[model samples]
Target chain A: MPSRAIQENFRFLVLEVTKQIESTVQVVTTGDEALIDSVYLKDDYIDNLRGFIDAKCLTVIRDADEGDERTVELARAVDIVTNNLERMADFAVNILRQYKYVKDHAILRGYGLEPLFAEVLGALGKVSEAIFKADVNEALEICRSEFNLDEMYAERFHRVMSELRAGGEQVEDLVTTLFIVRYLERMGDSLLNIGEAIISLALHERLKIHQYWALEETLDVGRGEAKGLSLESIFETRSGCRIGRVRDHREGAEGNLVLFKEGQRDKLLEERAGILFWQERFPDLVPKILSWHEGEHHASLLLEYLSGQTFQQILLEGTSDELRAALQALGTTLRAIWEATRVDEPVQPGFLGQIAKRLRDVKKVHPGFGDDDQTIGALRVPAFADLLRRAEAIEAELPAPFSTFIHGDFNVDNIIFDPAQDRLHFIDLHRSRRFDYVQDVSVFMVSNFRLPVLETTIRRRLSAVILAVYRFVQTFAQEAGDTTFEARLTLGMVRSFTTSTRFVLDPSFARAMYLRARYLLERLLAHEGGDWSTFSMPTNVLRY
Target chain B: MASDNHEFRHESLEDRTSIAKYLNALSEAFANGNLTFGHNGHAIELEPRGLLKFDVKATRKRGAVKVSIRLNWQEDEEDRDPSVGSLVISTSGEGK
Candidate 1:
């Protein structure tokens, strides 16, 4: 009978073999076959050693039956090798099956690999348990039987390979299957090696010496690595904390006033910058960051308190025009932030990728009026392709503009008002991205404004006002010689922005929006009679 | 339970204490609660010290008007840092 230590060795060998087979098959089945084929045998020095142990385990069991002194020594040797092999082979069969599944599908497996390997390893564990039992002399005999298994596997492999050689075109399926068969054969060979090692341990006093050295190194290496921490410090600190605070002046005013924490420092300094910037641009924004220390955890701002009821609260009491005016104010605040950022630059770092990503995310709403989810009545409009054309024409007619900084997120919440001052201030400056002028305007139209209240007519008029302001801002940029581009590239970039969002909006609305937008764009394009592709703008118009 | 002179001194201290309490409550309520003046001049300004006191004045062209009020001593950091606190309020006011 095998010792506990030998049983553990057998278990490890079985599990390791199981993992290798499963991972290999998972790769072939999952369309990661090339990746698996590249690394499958890179670390398989132990297979031969396991084969030797399985062969020897039989010897030890036989010696025990004969009551020889060699039986005890053989058991100890089997203990080490069998334990290692069992652990390796436990997932072997499932891994082969996974490869088979991947080959049959002839496609890349959609799921990730980690879970597949885990499940296979879990199932192969039962075989390892059988090896560890003291009374299982009969179970140890299986190790002696796998020399015959290898012959069967080799024959199957040859037959499949021969069939593949005779196959015609459309061989992806056949080739995939053949690859699966090869992985399956290798898996059988690994398991057979384990069985042979178990048998060998039963017959001899010592198992393969080469396996012990490698196993020791592998185990030591695995144990020496440090593990990652379970939680990040920021998340841990904020777990139960709520936003906003109230301080009692008389009881403890002194401690709360001097800001010291790191988060507070960044927050306060940012707030100071925000206040100064707002004072320069739009003075109406309230809760002004008065002064902030870079050392404080949060920014300190002076707030001009708002006393009026919220728009939602006053909905019943207000007239439609007042509601429209309030919403228009929100729209204006959003546009102000966009206008301040010089988004017309092309080569600014982080500009291209962000624009491209945003372009990709905008919905591809159907342009037809009859679609079930149409937002606007059917309006025949040029496809995104045509919009690109019109944009190109405009670009050719216009001068190339340099890129400028733009408010990255021009949303409703950033707007603040003080009726006393009749002022509007925009806050939350951290999302400053550089892109084309239209990027800010388009995103504001889609994200900030509601569908029903903002029809194409309103958007068109608002966009005109925004464009007029943009034109004024662009003059400053233009004098700086930054707004230069060939008409075509400008059109392409603008088209990309509009189409990107058009893809995401409801089909009917998208069509109406796109048609109206194109009408405005065509007016710009017609103003410039030349083709857009022939135009060019200076690249170095905006600098960091 | 005290002498007449002692009692008189105690009453004087009580008046000062009451004033502090009253002013603190008024200042706090003005900052936090929704107390709208009918016109521009109705407003409250609070100083940073522990005392609770306020000056209610008329907006642009209006005269100062008497108003009914209630006060509570809620606090806010006069600035952003949590270390300092200024009384805030959950107070109410009615125009006369």
Candidate 2:
């Protein structure tokens, strides 16, 4: 069979690379120039073997049975594996060459070099399982090996640079050692590429190596004591946090699923604080934080995975009754939380400032959309920057009449709905805070409107949801005598719609949103120093 | 997801003679499973086939009258990349 042929050739290629690595390590450590012959001798064999494997890959893919998905995936994976392995073998040769330049061959031994070799070799050992068995945990270990190798290289590199800077007689040795460490770091990078390729093939989706490592480490630290765990990448946020859902297959841990999130330290800490705030106020409304961990400059959290579908899912695929139920549940939760945590103090959210922070990203996507001040016969329109400046000033003067603890993101996806329990749960609490409730209300409306599905039916559902949330919140505002709610909501919408265009590339759709944002800015600019309560938000702008 | 999108749009008033000619051309293009629209020195090509969603809405409010027509269909992505943006929309199931 083509598969058997490909596997056998691949096995031979791997063996050749392994031998090359082993021989290189042996010569570098023993300080024996004669041993370098074997390393050089094997280089030709490794290169030829890689070429052979590459040729076989083309053959199998071209001649295999049609629609043989397994063969196709395996072939593609082998293609990636051999390419990285060849580069790694080349790096090993590069190291052997650099080793000869050092005045003292023994000098390489002084800088924790053995363990770094071990880490690289150890990663190669797992390459088999990563490719053949398609073991995710094995792939995770392989990827983490690079991070470990980097730490080792960093320490040695610092000493080498420092010694060279000191202008010592051992400069040759230190500089050569510097070149050698760089090769080791390159080997680690190849290992990462090989591991991620296997993982992408195994999962039928591309998974980044660091993201895989993050998920594994979070599981290891938090509720990861349970064995036989499987991970699936769910979503990643613009904030660069890797989000995944994990299922525990350990005995008695069946159906135990949790979400693992890892990102910059401050972001995760903020999320932890948000969760704690909700837990104290209404525990059931937010996902319970299972565990939290921080190291270096990053943090990870294991959150109890609510089985409920997100509100976005309900709008797309749920029955009418289910949609209504979720909407009703969400409304009730918002009302109760607002009433319970309402603080009678004025608070300015800097919604326009928030837009300014992301304006660069928006410009990155829609470069020509940013406008300069323009004039008609009887009118002058301010530039986007000038409008934002005015809006910021206006926002400072017209703070929300009251403050309440609110979902900082308030996206449709962050809110989960459990049909079985008829409960609503929130996730990604990093942005949760005591802000103007209008911020949450406006975010929810725009999130619904921004969903890319544009079939008429879903659009109607989105419009209905936005309207329902608007009327519901408007009633709450009127009851609380929050007369400035409309004025603030328009500004909030301006922030969301303007910034959200970055995520969408549909030109017509993006322009619609950008134009609406500009129109709102104009309207807001036109109403300067007016009675804030008299300012009414044109709700149709929130409609799809 | 990395988005590579093309767009075509135009806004102008037209007489029935021009409107009829433009729409007749559009109908022919749609029937041929290929449509290209141009505006302001830019053009976009679209492929429409199989079942399509058609929508129309109209309103006559104040001193203005408006009408909108929308067409929707799925693109054929036989070799769609599994990894795009982080967002994945899927129905709830047993497990991955």
Candidate 3:
């Protein structure tokens, strides 16, 4: 039923969305204000195109002959594709708008988003090719390549979340980064839909691309068994994986099974291998890997569903006693993990490298902060760049301590605590490795303190927990005679305070954090003979 | 979108003195009820007789500040004195 004009318009819409994607990629990678502004300008044009397509599609559908199923179906497909392309363009505009915030803040350089833009642009390019050529093979490639985007999204999302949990400053920028990646992932999803629609038109058969892929994975269970297995959609990961709980009604599986489809055999196998490794070492800590399937086109892992509340949930609703208990248990678990993973060899602490990177990010976001007389809140802070340079020089004189195994992402949210069984479980352990134990300790302390609640009671309780953990860690460091403990902790605090800038949008909270970091840097500079142990942490550092 | 009856002119001035000179020339034309200007052999003339509308605006963004002044008036109508609104100016210690 669609006319030639409508078809041409739809093609043009696809091309325009692709162009928008290209421009967004450029803006994100290069931080070009002109490109960002141009994207904003194109928004009106994209909206107008969407309106024109909708009108044309409606006219075609109304004018179609009675009982003309093919024409009607074709018109519907065009309408769906047009709607998706328009949404994709809207997301492109959203990315640019967020980029303005990034530019204003100047946290551009170390986000590692350029590679993601490249991947998304590449995926979008293939989608455009598939749509233009009406090539089924190209369309299939787009569908298959979605897993790559999902993988990248998951990696970036988890990393940012970890940094946030660890008190990485630039919270605003990191959160924006998360949204931008999410938009890119959604754009990829729409592109996949467009690719599927093209394939459907070319083959003259309706195909739901995602559903087809899901069915393909489910059918591997055997056709007869697949029919009885019902999948309820849970949520999609940022990395584009379709995750759901599958249950066999006929067999009455004891627990709901989690389904993970990466659409690639090797990647899924790698994940399965990692899960198995954790299951072997920490049997009670991770979910059980029940079964896995690897097909020619896709791979999936079925994991046992662990029933309990995540630590994030408990933190919100749990009483002070419950929180204290959780923190105590958390400290014990961390000690166990550290004991299991600590190495005899001492390596240089990456304080200078880490602080230098964050300082650069801060400079990027608040270039004016480099001025010595810049006032943050009621406090006059020295040039941030100069302070960082001083901190680097001070760090050069300190000793590097032994490394320990740590949950690289020690955010409470990733932890699951079963009070009834008195057990602690961990998820999203992809970043687990041998690193500074302070990484976990600092993240735990900050995560507790960073909860959105502002009530005096809640703040006091959270502060108490932070103090308890700090004292516990300090005791351990003293018992072990780790003289560099204070310096390492100071560095961790610096990372936390500066990175808090990204997360806390409130001007007062941000200024408090900036002033806190400035105070610590001043102390580090004033301390003679590099004796970090004598450097006292201000009691009011966490006041805000 | 081309019009034969419409004429437009543009010029950039180096400083306030040059801007004042241009404003003086335009003010004299308005006072005489006849406006004329020539540049690069292109010239225009008009007889103005109407109440004029004046606008003033100031804006600051992204480190740049701009203040714009504009005047618009109709042609071939009886002249009338421009109406003035109540004006109250206050200065703060903070410099603009």
Candidate 4:
């Protein structure tokens, strides 16, 4: 809480519009025409005030240092709140004009507008208080107002449809009546925008309504109390999920925390299932799922945040001994899981198919990767598209002799190392499935290869790490009598190397990955064999 | 190590006058059948042969404007395959 108050004009603008909304309710209550016209005229004043506040916000932001996140976020929230307030005022004037179209107020009663108007008024009152006082609970109430408006509109809409279907008279009046509720819905959306801006102001991070709800729900479920607990979002993923860590910040509340994730329903479902699977088998090897909830199209997963450094942190920052210890622990975990969960089912990994699915994304990022077939005197350079068909032919015969529970996207970042406990944990398990262990192996190798560390010493360390894992997995394969492990690994590496490029933006790095794919495809095309065991992945190719 | 590799690459946003100047130079080069492009210690000189490929493309989609002009021709002294198809990586554990 900054002892210095927020700028007065922004507060004044929001409060002024909120007062107008209350007065509009009064007009709707008393059916006063002159008062309605005054509400309509006051909308222009709100618009001008919005402009003044917007410029003042920009000036405040421009004057603040870039590192002053608090000042910048405050200015941004004020700007967003003012804009949404102006929109609500505009919607108010629109409703007043449209209400005149209904000649007979009796026929206009679908579900009634009084309840909708009252909710908007309630939500608008909170916006001024939420922004000025930095009240998160009040902001949440404003968000719930949007939800309430939706329910009222849904009921009204259902009745309107029935009346229209009945082929009754006064269709124009019925439709205009619906438009009034629609305007209410629009005003509700503005309130949501204003509420979210204030919530973002309080948390110092911007959040969507679903993400805010996810955090609130997770907190409530985790400890049966969400009041007085502040939220801080760690990051928002490209998938539009919220990943945050929650803490009990009370005086005696020390070191009790949980990782909160809210994402697409299907993704969180997969993650919950994966965590349960790992819990049933190796309890300490993955995070404990504390709570889970699904709302609308999104889901929230609350897990005890594991206490350790990720393999990524070890590789990038820790000592060489730490890296080696992490790798060895990872190898041990893989061996245990593979041995325990290995199923006797011959599975073709469809590595080429995986590459094919992601080709569009790859070309979307690096358009030049979509190469054309070239003829150079005596040589035929098949296009990348042509290479896939040829490689799929080789991939057809080589299937792993068994399937195991594997992390579908097993990169270094997902694996956590707790040196104190000498244990490994997995997070981000949305992609877990019963598949060939080679998929995890290939991703591990490519992940180590493509670490973005160009320093000579660290690059060598990555190569060594890749080699160590490859040897460990290869020994496991040999003992399991998976004869075609090397061949399947070749195809798997090609799939990983190619699809991984789409996620990277550095041109040279993407090129390196794309060329490796091309090189592997060329190798597959050149090989003539039904004996898959003779095929081997080149260690040199994986070095860089 | 004389090779038939002539490379000229550029990427930037050119204003109207700058583009006109570049186009005029290209037009004169086309008339003379010779073009030289030089920048930052990298340079290339080319002379058109019997057959030349000219490709022009303009795209306006997805909030982007792209214009490309390409001219290519085979060199007279080109007798090699001009392919790295013989590239082979050893599977042996040399690092071991």
Q: Can you write out model 3's per-residue Cα lDDT over B1-96, one digit (the tens) per residue? A: 121375767768568776888878888998997876667776677666433445567799998988887876544211222231111111111111
If you superpose only chain B onto the true chain B, what TM-score does each candidate give?
0.22, 0.67, 0.58, 0.63
Off by over 4 Å in 1: A1-356, A363-383, A386-408, A433-506, A518-544, B1-96
Q: Compose the digit string of candidate 1's lDDT tens values, residues A33-140.
A: 554543345235445546656666666666575556555554554544454444344334334444544434532242223333343344344345433442123223
Off by over 4 Å in 2: A19-42, A58-73, A88-130, A135-213, A221-227, A349-398, A452-454, A494-511, A514-536, A540-544, B1-96
Ranking by lDDT: 2, 4, 3, 1
- Give stretches of model 4 more than 4 Å off: A1-7, A36-45, A98-114, A153-182, A219-225, A238-240, A249-255, A342-346, A363-397, A477-483, A505-508, A521-536, B1-96
Candidate 3's C-alpha runs over 4 A off are A1-233, A236-252, A257-279, A290-302, A358-381, B1-96
Query: Ten residues in a row with the worst lDDT in model 2 chain A?
Result: A221-230
Model 2, backbone clash pairs (residues 3+ apart or across chains), number: 2
Model 2 earns a TM-score of 0.70
lDDT of 2 by residue, A64-137 (tens): 78978677778888989998999999998899999878777667788757898899889998887678987766
Quote each prediction's TM-score: 0.28, 0.70, 0.49, 0.74
Cα-based lDDT at residue A501, candidate 3 = 65
| Best candidate according to TM-score | 4
Q: Reference contacts recovered by each candidate, as fractions?
A: 0.00, 0.00, 0.00, 0.00
List iRMS (one decimal) for every candidate: 21.6, 13.1, 30.3, 14.0
